[model samples]
Each structure stands twice: as structure tokens, then as C-alpha cells.
Target: MKITVILCYAMFLGACLSFLGGCASGKSSASRVEVTPFSCVLAPDTNGSVCVDVVFRVPSQYLSRRSRLIIVPQLLLDGKLSEELTPLVVDAPIYAKKMYRRKVVQNYQDPYDAYTGKVEGVSGGLELPYRETLTIPLGVHTGCVQAIVTEDGCGGCTGLDTVEVASVRNLASLIQDTFELVRMEPTFHEGKVEVLLQFLINRHEIRSDLGNNRSQLKKLAGSLRPILADTLTRVGDFRIYGMASADGSRAFNTTLARKRAESLREWLLKELDIHPELYTRMVVDSRPEGWLPVYQAMVDDGHPDSLFVGQILRRYPGSDDDVQEQYIRRLSCWKDICSRYLQKDRKIECAYTYTSYESVLATDGMWIPFPIKQMEANNQAILCLRRGQFEKAVDLLKDFVHYTPATMNTLAVGHFRKGDVKSAEKLLRKVKLPEAFRNLGVLMALQGKWYEAYRFLKGSGSLNEAVVALILSYNEEAEAIMAELSDQSPLAEYVRALVTSRLGDDVAFEVHLKNACQLDELRLRAAGEPDFEKYREDKIFREIVK
Candidate 1:
């Protein structure tokens, strides 16, 4: 009986030792917890939450009486961890020496007690297959969900076991500027042809003594051929204001003026082979004796008689037809006046408006040629600029001089588009053109000079200016400017949508956003814009951006 008691005690002792050893060696740290492949999904629930499900497997031996499982979850966006979600705590079975003999867990409390304490569970040979569903708000940018599990068991603990839950994405820009229309107008050339014809005294007939007079008439008539051939021409009256010399009687001189003008018109028509009907409408009028020419000639001759001539003209001022000439012919300067000036008084002056066409072939696009050859380079550069060849445009304009305000403005724009804002601003200071103001405003807005940008952009009526206003939170200004945009460009409307969204005008926002997406034709760009962040959870916003 004594021997049997001793053997039974030893057996009990040995069994207790074996049980304690098993608990101490509880599945090596590597096999403690195993999580299956899981990932965060982009499926947004009706509650504006993104759902992610994960499965964890805890081996039977890993659940010791003193051990607990703590899971810390975090969302990583663009490789950065999110701090919004709370960590999860799940306690496991603790197999104490006395509790092992009972074969049942005691004091099993829910791990979510919100306190730091140990919980108990049944000490069974069954493995734990756990599944959990985590809901994260859709507002968070979650590229991946990470789960870090650590066992709070024996004196020493297992290092962190990390599981990555990658998120799935199932969802799917004009630098707008104002352009002026190019217009081409026909070129016009204007000139006058004057003819001085001589006639025999008191006679309306042409004289042989006249030198080169016929040749002069022929030259004048021939010049009209080229003018008449122009696409557009306006022929003025062929005027012949005839005058008489001071020696002739008033009545005879008048008759001679009229007859001489008529004879000259007839001769021109016959000699030039022009229609007589056209000459009939020509102007032929008689004027008083041409005394002004005689006075002017005496003054121009610088003769000693000029002082006496001026005194005589000023002393005797009469409106009579030949009074002045009558007195002048009696003076010593009379010969100088008649010989130099009276001969020039008998003349015909002809003038007409002529418009010609010049064809300028553009390289491509809607570029027009510059009016002057010096600016041809600028024209070509503008063409290149319109085609988005900024570097080529810059190269073409590199050596260009004679910069007009328009050319400077275009070159500045090219430089701005190339990210050379300093150079662009330098050129802009030379001109206060509206385009220059708008470009400067755009640059200022990019540099975060909001107030300065507003100052420059105000009243510009440019779509880019409106965009800057919207970005700077100048709602009233943005709305006012955007309303004036006739093109309703996608970028402009998109900015309007942002303004409306801020004002809580959902209907208008939706309307504008829809139009923007339609015109722009790409939803992804809208998705990346920060202005729409608040609407990320809205179904309409999602649909449009997607």
C-alpha cells in the first residue's frame, strides 16, 4: 500500500511538470498567429465607409492562460500610415497550473472592456479561426491597410507580426487663354497727277512752242492704266481750274479759261483713247486772274523789287478780278513774277483712291503675316506658339527686334508657359496691355501672391484670371468674371463649380461640374483636384469624377 501511494504522487507530480512545460513552450513565436492575404477595398458603403475584411488564424497551442492578442490597425496612404482608426484588443485562453487541471477557462471577459486586463477562455485543443470586418471612412485616402499583431503572454512577448491589406481602386487640362481673331485687309495706294499745259495768248489752241507738254500729258494718262487695273479704285474729278494772264481783258480771259479747259479735256480723251462720256463729267471751271502766284514768285526771287512788290500789294487791296495783277505787271518785278510763277498757275490736278490686294500665305494654324518685313519673325513665332511648340517659338523670336506691344505680349506668354516667369515678368513690365496684366496675374497666383494677383486680374475678362480668383477664394469676383466668359470653357466652368460647391449650391454645382466633365472629357483630372475633396463621398461627385 505504501509503495502504491508513493508511485501515484510521483505520477501526479510528473503530469503537472509536463503541463507547465507545454504552456511555457506554447507554439514557437513564429507559429503564434497566422493572417491570410487581405487587402483594403475601394468599395464605399452607403454610410460613406470603405469596407475591409481580414481573417486571422490562432493555433490551439498559442492560446495559453497568460497570453492575449493585440491588433493595431492603421491605414497607409501613399506609403504613410493613417492615425484615424483605433487599435483592436482580443484576449485568449490562459492555462494556469490549477486551471489546467479544471480543463475549463475561468473569468472569460470580452477583450473590448476598454481596460488593461487579462481575459480567460476555454483550454481546448480547437484552433481559433477569427475573421473581422473593419470599416474606414471614405474620406480617408487609404492606399493600404496594415495590421500589426503582438502577443501579450508570458514574461517575454513575440515581436510585432505585420500584415498589409492593400487597397483596390476600381474607379477611373487646357491652360485656357483668350485668342484674338486675325483679319486681313486689302492694301491701298493713293497718288495725284498734275499737268501744266500752255496755250497761245487769247487762243484755246495748243502751241508748238510748248516744250514736253504733250509728253507730260501722255505720261500722266499712262500712269492711270496701272491705277485702273487695281482691284478697287476711286477716280476723282479731272479738275481744270483755268486762269488768265493779267494782260488780257476780263471777258476775253474768262472765255479763254473756259475754252482752254474744254480743249484740253477733249485732247486728253482723244490722245488717251478714253471715253468722251467719262470726260464730259470732268471738272472745268474759270477762276480770277492768277495774281497770288505772281506775288509768291516775286517774294521767292529774293529781288530788290520784292520789298516794293509787297508794299504795292498791301497798299492796294481790291477784290477786282485783275486789279492786283494789273498793278504788279506795271512794276519792275512784273517780269520776274510772270516768267517764274504765272506759267505754273495754268495746271490740272488729278487724284484718286486705289486699293490693292496682297496675298500672304501662312505656314499653318490661323497666323496672319505682320504688316512689316521686320516683324515676320514674330509672326512665325506666334504660329509656332499656337501649335504648342514653345521652344521653337522662342528660337524663332530670339533675334527679333522691333517688338510691338502685341509681339512682346506673345513672347512673354511663351516664356511664361516655359516656366520662365522671371523672363516673362521682365518683358511684361514694358507694356500695360490687358494680356500682359492677365499673364502677370496668372504668375502671381501661382506664386501665392493672392492679393496682388487679384489686383492684376480684376476686370481682365480672362478665363485664367477667373480661375485664379476662384482658387484664391474670391467667390464674388470669380462668379462675376466667369459669367462674362462666352466660351464656357471646361476650365472656367470647373472653377465655377468649385465656387458653387463652396456656396452650398448643390444643384448649380452639379450642373456646372457635369458640363465641365463633358467639355474636358476626362474625369481623373477632376478627381485629383483638391477643390473637390469635400464631395468625395457624394454619389454625384463620384460619378462625375470617376
Candidate 2:
């Protein structure tokens, strides 16, 4: 195949990959290739890491003639400057049209680019990104560019040109990691009380002047006013968490969460003398409704806590108004103590307002500010759920998000535990799952769209669920994944074992299972993970145990 490099005399249309030193290969037919989102990546960015992917298309005709596709990728930042490392290659390409990648690096620089200038070594299937180490800056820089390509074509070929490439944008914000724990520095002095509040629960600073407890509120405010003033003046950083419980309607919880957050904000500004200047960075920790689930999460996750969920649950059981109010107040106080030391981020915004549940729930109740009857249930349910009363909350509310392959397919075990496949399919329709639903390959598989899934998952440049779906699956599609597993072959074998088992192919299953056991040591960290349900039943699986 002749990839005619239609360059106007080596102008280099944004750094290109030239074929090998060949005499034009007998001037063959036009070889076509395509690339998407043109960036090459190194490793997995599942945690705090970063990733890059480049999409390029190559002729299917020359594919069988070679065993692999050789791709040389480069990194560029701030327009013209290249990364510390210039070019590298990945052996076998997985997708002819697109490539996916993950990266691991710590950077303070801005505007990153992943580019490929050449492609070589061809076989069947997609391609892989070159693996190498490179530094990425974390500053915000716009309009920067980089390229990755298959540069090993006929070097002496007059038609030497870039068939595909990728790019990257270095943004100036840190990823607010979801799994990150509450960052707190403890201080202890004789007779001084230090409180702890997890971001998951009691995220907002609420300001509700209960008519029944107005006197108590005022008195408490007065006593803390001086300390509040000092705390506000010394304020350097803040973390406002938006919280809601699973006890009410999704509509109600959403609104209630926002309002409670404001209530806390108001109290801080008024009695605490906190400056209004720090408003923008004060984000409410947005979470599911109800303090109980949050409290439970903290307890299970081993976060700092003043009281256990069981103790707090005993305080309020949905019927006692006084019990509910007391719990709310104690939680508020604890949050204040924690906030007194919370380091605020200058870039995040804090200016916001929320409508309280009491206010919104009161339709004609003059005592309530935002009046509407149904709104009360959401706020009340959250309280109940926090008190370890899920049954009561469910009676008053409906489940909002669904766990499933389409919803959070990245999380197979969680969804499996929440419900069976039948229920998952139904729930997935409504959940806003990222990437999970945006993939055609995975979707096609659900509808028995095998070939289509292959087209999308195998060739698409971006990291769609379809391409990596094999990592969690074992079907014909999964078999394709093994050939390209590279240094990550053990992972592929384990997945193959699972798929073969699902298909009732015992022979294939055992073979891959053994292969997976050998590699289990490499991934021993995932040993007890519930996600490995498929392997838990096999005897050989026990052999992999450390």
C-alpha cells in the first residue's frame, strides 16, 4: 500500500511520521488511515494519575501483512516545547482507527499535548500507545499542541507522511477526587474540645431559627460569636459540602441539600463574623440525602467521628421532633468546630444560597419561609435515614440513582450487590453514568450487537467502555483482548477465565484460570476484592493466594 505523503516539500503538517527507507514500494495503491483526538497515553489514570489517547485509522488491506502496528508518540506543552522524552513506541495496536491510554505523572506545568508522528509494523486489530516516562506541567496554558503517529513507514518513500495523531489540553484545576478522605489536622489543648466532621455527612452549615428553639439558638450564637469572629478573620481555606439524604423524593433532596448548605453559610457569616469575601470557594459537598447513610459510610470507611452511627440512630427514630432537632444542632456544632480549621481553596467558588426543608415544605404555614408540603418529606426522610431508619425513608421516598453496567459499569461488584441483572437494566435507564452509557460497543453487546461493539470498542480512539470492556468480560470479544494485553497479559487471562466460564467452556476456562493464577501475584492487591467473584469458585484460584 502506498501512503502518498502529499506534503508540499517537507513543510511537515504539524510533525509527521515518515515510512521506512523504501523505494516507494513499487508505487502501490493509495493507503488510507484515520486518527481521532490525537493523543498518546502511557498508563492508567484511575486514581490521581492522568491519561492520553490518540485515534488514527490505517488501511485494513496492509493489516494482515504485518504482526503489529508500531506507533511513535511525542508530548508537547506550551506550543513548541517538547517533553523531557521525545518519541517512543507501543508494539501491537488494538484499534486501527483509535487508541486509548492512561498516564502516571506529577506536574505543575500547563497545556499538554500527546502526538504521534509515525506508524509501522502492521497486523490485524487496533494499535497501542508507546510506553515511556515523561513530565507534565500543571499550569493552565491554552492553544498548546502535541502529536503521536506511526512514523516507521518507508523512510525514503517520497510519500512519507503522518496518517494519524492526537492532542491534549492541560487545565489549571486539581481533580476533586471523590475517594479522597476528609483532610484534617487535629489540635488538642487542656480542657479544649476539638470536633470532627466528615465531608460525607453534615456538609453544610445550616441557619434555621426554630421558633420552638429560638431562645436556645440565640443564646448559643452569642456565646460563640467572639470565637466565630476570630475564626472568620483567620480564615485561610474552606470546604463546603452539599449533602442530602436518601429519605425523600429526588427532587426534594436536591433542593433540601442546597438549602441546608446555605443555612450553615448564613450562620457562619452572622454569628461567627466570617467574612463574605470567602464565599466563592465555599462549595457544598453534594451527596445523597440523609445523614444516616453518610454517617454509616464514614464509619465503615474509618473516617474521624465523634459518635458511632448506632448511637446517633438511637437519638432520632422519625417520630420525635425534639430528638431530630437536637441531633441537627449537635451536628451543626461539630461541623463548626471542624470548619474553624478548614483550609479554603482560593479558586473554588462559595457564593450560593439554599432553601431550607422547613421553609419549602410549608405550603400555608406562615412560620415556614419557602412553603410546600411535599418538601418537608425530603428533609425529614434524610434525618430518619441518617438515624439508621432506611425503611421509614423508603416509605417516604424513592431510590434515585441505579447501580448497573450502564450506570457505573466501571463498578461491576457494587451494582451486582445492589440488585440482580434484571433490576440493573431497569435502573440504568435513568442514572447519569459517565462513559458507561456513552459507548456504542458495550451497548451493542447488550442488544447482541457484537460486531458493532467490536467496531466501536476496538477502533474508537477515546477510552470508551467498549474497548476496555474485555478487561471485565470473557467472550469472543474478550479473546481479542488477550492478543493485545502486552505486559498486562495476566489481567487479560483472568478476564478470559471469567468469559469462558460464563460460556460454559470449562477447558478454556481452566487454561486461562491457571495463567491468571500465575499473574495473580502481580495483582495480589485485588485478591480480596469482591469484583473478582468469578475466580473465587475455582480451586486453582486458591493457589494464587499469597
User: Best by lDDT, which number?
Assistant: 1
For candidate 2, the TM-score is 0.20
Q: Estimate each model's TM-score.
A: 0.38, 0.20
Q: What is the C-alpha RMSD of each candidate to the true structure, in Å?
A: 19.4, 29.3
- Stretches > 4 Å off in candidate 1: 1-371, 388-392, 400-402, 417-419, 519-522, 525-546
CA error at residue 507 for candidate 2, angstroms: 63
RMSD of 1: 19.4
The local lDDT score (0 to 100) that residue 23 gets in candidate 2 is: 24
Model 2, residue 41: distance off in Å is 11
Query: Which residue pairs of candidate 1 clash?
Result: 64-93, 64-94, 65-94, 65-95
